[model samples]
Target: MTEALYLDNPYLELVEATVTAVGTDGGLYVDRSIFYPQGGGQPGDCGSIEWGTGLRTNIKNTVYSPDRSSIILIPRGDQDLPQLGQTIIQHIDWARRHALMRMHTAMHLLSVVLPYPVTGGQVGIEEGRLDFDLPEGETVERVSANDAINALIRADHAVTTEWISDDELVANPTLVKTMKVKPPTGAGRVRLVRIGADIDLQPCGGTHVKSTGEIGEVHIAKIENKGRINRRVRLRFGPSAESA
Candidate 1:
């Protein structure tokens, strides 16, 4: 199994790892990685890998194995692939990852503050969005939602993660209450992200900021109604926004 370094410390942009295996298809697998694979509505990470020979190859994208057991690092262009068992160093594009981290955490806050089910979502370096399944007669006003989110951000609440066993999760159904998305179980343990004392709580594998204040001032740039229930809320960070 590949050790996902990002899970333990999202701020870690660089890490040393050994090439566990090299795929015949030209992909490379490392013993440990800081690269965030493309999944959970978040885009793949882009960076580079450096070998002992001082040769560095740019990573164009990252993906998970079919079984979600390992990560595949796709090189940007044709290059001499690193040999298996070779020591290599990995570096993540911190600017991009940091933005996504803040945007992702903001999304969780959005899920909690909005009185609707999330139909869909996406996280990007400059912007992020979440589509909510609204109830009839209820309209999601961008101004109101933006104001509420900023208010929470100003509160500077601490964000934390916890692990729960499968059986314990099954017994406490309320522990999984947030929206339609269920906490991942049968994986030995579940990771829960908690924001503040009673602000938001949900199962998430995505990286997030340590506090709500790190999200800065986010503005709801657009709100699109895709159907009777699905409404998309787009968020953007301004130039003066603080970094996480």
Candidate 2:
């Protein structure tokens, strides 16, 4: 099984690993990895791998195996492939990944403040968005949402993660109440992210900031009606709503 280093430490940008297997589809499977594969509304990591001999390959994208036991790395352009059992160094594009972490954390805060069910969401380097199923005749208020979310950011609440068994989670329904999207349980165990003592609690697998203040200033830039019940709210980091 591949060790997911990102789960324990999201800030780990570089790591040494051994190439365990090479797929016929030109994907490389490593023994351990810090790369965040594409899933849970967050994009996959983009980075490169370097062999000890000075040979390197650019990792274009990462995808999880069907059983989640390993991650497949697709190379970008033609490059010398590392042999199985060979030692290699993996480096993640920290600037982009850091932005995604901030955006992902901001989205969680948005879910906590906004009183609506989330329909969809996506994290990005430039901005992030969440579509919500709002109540009837409810108007979109960017200023109010922005103010509430920023207030929580200023609170500097600590973020922490915990593990809960499937049986235990099922026994406590209230523990999963704040989750915008229900986590897939049956995987043996689930990770619960707690923002503070009682500020916000949800099941998440994506990378996030250590505290709310690290999210900086997030502004609700736009709100559009995608359907009768779907309202998409876009967010970005800035002071002016128009610029964000």
* For model 2, the run of ten residues with the poorest summed lDDT: 174-183
Report the C-alpha displacement of residue 81, candidate 2, in angstroms.
1.0
- Residue by residue across 1-244, what tens digits does model 2's lDDT show? 7888888799998999999998887789988989998988899999999996788899999889888889877888667788889899999999989999989998888988886777788899879998888888987777777899999999999988888888888887766543366777887888888898888877788899899999999898888999987889998887764545
Q: Per-candidate TM vs. native? A: 0.91, 0.93
Highest-scoring model, lDDT: 2
123: Cα error in model 2, Å: 0.7
Worst 10 residues of 1 by lDDT: 235-244
Separately for all candidates shown, the number of backbone clashes (residues 3 or more apart, or on different chains) is 0, 0
Give candidate 1 misplaced runs (Cα > 4 Å): 172-183, 239-244
lDDT (tens digit, per residue) of candidate 1 on 1-244:
7888888788898988888778878788887889988877789899998886789988989888777788888888778778889888898888888899999998888877785767678898888888887887788766667778888999999999887878877777665443555655667988878999888876777888999999988877778889877788888885323223
